[model samples]
Target: MNFHPSHPLQAFWNLAAAPIQAMALEQALEHRLFTLLAQPATAASVAQQLGLNAASTAVWLDLLWSMDLLVRHVPAGKAEPGYAASPLAARFFVDASPENCAQSWQYRARSLARFAMQWCTLLREGFEPDGRTKEGAAASTGSWAQAAREQIGQEQRVVTAPAVLHLMDALPPLPRQGRFLDLGGGPGHVAIALARRLPGWRGTVCDQSETAEVAQDNIRAAGLSDSLEAMGRDLSHEAIGGGCDLIWCSSVLHFLHDPQAALSKMFEALKPGGLLLLAHAELADDPVLAARVMPFYAGVMLRGNHLPQPGEVAGMMARAGFAGIHALGRIDFPMAPVWVHMGRRP
Candidate 1:
């Protein structure tokens, strides 16, 4: 039998070395190397600009160059090659660009470095012990809430914003000037975007107290203060204000310890015939992509959050008294794919 046993070890090493790539990219973003390298400069000059050691800086730059994130150049009569942002980096990594993805990279890098490595400990300890440990909890001083707000902005810009906008466009006609609810909406981007689309509609983004503050700021910044507002409400206990129209909930279900109860509450919050959009990533449907991103959600699950399986969400919606349920298929996002399941109150 012809078998290739020689490369079996290669997979192990590749998996081990994956973190280094993310960490290195994070460091580069932290140093604003791509921004500085908008113009070509030798490694020595780049190092001096960033106050980094020349040798170490050169190594990092060379690594990025090898990755094709940067391009090398040799000016006429110049001995050392200069480096600059690659075409891909120029369009996506530059801070001035509307499509900048630096925030997404930075957030993921920080999260992975801080939380992704604890899988063994998580498995052994049977999940994170701290029940109150939630994302964006900066510290006892509530500083983390602000950070969470910033991270949520990044998430909206990179992932949720586009998918939501696309889905809204594809949605069937609905009443104008209706009450729209963004359940567990962080930073309120989705609501703001939708409000922008439906000029007559008013929106409310509901989240925890800290996140509500951030969402308020985001609403004001988007110049939709008159049309949109943010409110603090815990769906697990507190009531989500009654509404007469559409409700959008994205990426919030999997994080709840008891999603079914929360969905039940949401169902009550909606008016008769009101629509609810529940969006999440369904792992079993796309194992190939899940293999790459499972660790991120796994880390959340380890923190005592519930990560739903493929069909669990649909079942939950049905049990929560939702009607006319339908699937919107997978939305291809810049970060990852998400499956949207919609239901209407009968």
Candidate 2:
């Protein structure tokens, strides 16, 4: 038998050290280090430009390189090496890139980190209702509105829009000219993308008053004011307006007081033979897949929100009088993969 040396605690140690890596990335983002490193620059030059300590900056650059966020280059006869943003950093982290999601990423990271710190206490004593949800509908709406203005729009524009567009390709042909509702649409980027794809179609985005205002601004900026409108209403209490052809709702059901009733509301809102595309992260059987989803939504579940199990949403849709229901597999979202289900009202 061959003997091998191993450390049993390696995994735990890595888990313990995970925050160090996160902080390193956060600091780089905070200082706009990747923007500066977009082009190759020596540590000394970077330190001078950013007013960072010379020796410490060199060490930090090496750490970033080790993390694969930056690349290092050595020039002939040069004592110092040059560092530049790695391909991954250049594409997603650089400020100049249109696909930049650094701000949005940071927003989610900070929020999750705060929640993570409270996990032990929450598990022991349960969560206290906060302004995010425990308060009245007005306060919850306010929180979502803030997210819309701050990071939701960026996430939608850079991440959700593309994934939704790709998913739509798999659906059967949609009508050339029809009305659609973007349920819980933040900033209305998804609706704008659809409108651009289906030029003859008009669309509505419904959310809280403040979030709807954000969507309205985006609609006007996209030059879609003529065809798209934003409706401000409490979806839980108020009726989501009647819709004709299509409805695209994603990640909204988890927060609703009664997901089944909301599905029924959507059923009544749709025209006969209308399509409903519902996308949300569901608890998975596979541990790896579950890990992709659970951590991001652990706080939500702890706060008394429902994270659906696999095939759970489809059952609710069926109970609500939707027909031709089927799962459309999973699609990548900002932090996790969401299962998409399609149903039609008969």
Best by TM-score: 2
Candidate 1 minimal-lDDT segment of 10 residues: 132-141
Error of 2 at 23 (Å): 1.0
Clashing pairs in 2: none
For residue 107, what is the lDDT in candidate 1? 69
Please write out the lDDT profile of model 2 over residues 1-346, one tens digit for every residue: 7586668988779889888878889989989999998789999999999899999889888888989999998999998999999999988898888888898888898999988889789879897665444457667677778888768888998899999999888777787899999999988999999999889999999887899999999999999999999999778899987856999999999888788889998999999999999999999999989999998988878878889998899899999999999999999999999999999999
Report lDDT per candidate.
Answer: 0.80, 0.90
> What RMSD does each model have against the real structure?
3.4, 2.3
Can you write out model 1's per-residue Cα lDDT over 1-346, one digit (the tens) per residue? 8685667689789889877766777787788788899889998998898898999888888888887889998999999889999998887777887767787677667767767566577668765356545553445326535655765576676667777988887989887778889988877877888888889988899988888899899888888999999998767678887864888987777767788898888898889999999888666656687875576677666666776777788899999999999888878653557788999999
Cα error, candidate 1, residue 82 (Å): 2.4
Segments of candidate 1 deviating more than 4 angstroms:
1-11, 76-79, 128-144, 332-335
Residue 193 error for model 1, in Å?
0.8
Spell out the clash pairs found in candidate 1: 138-144
Candidate 2 regions with alpha-carbon error over 4 angstroms: 1-10, 130-140
- What TM-score would every model get versus the actual structure? 0.87, 0.94
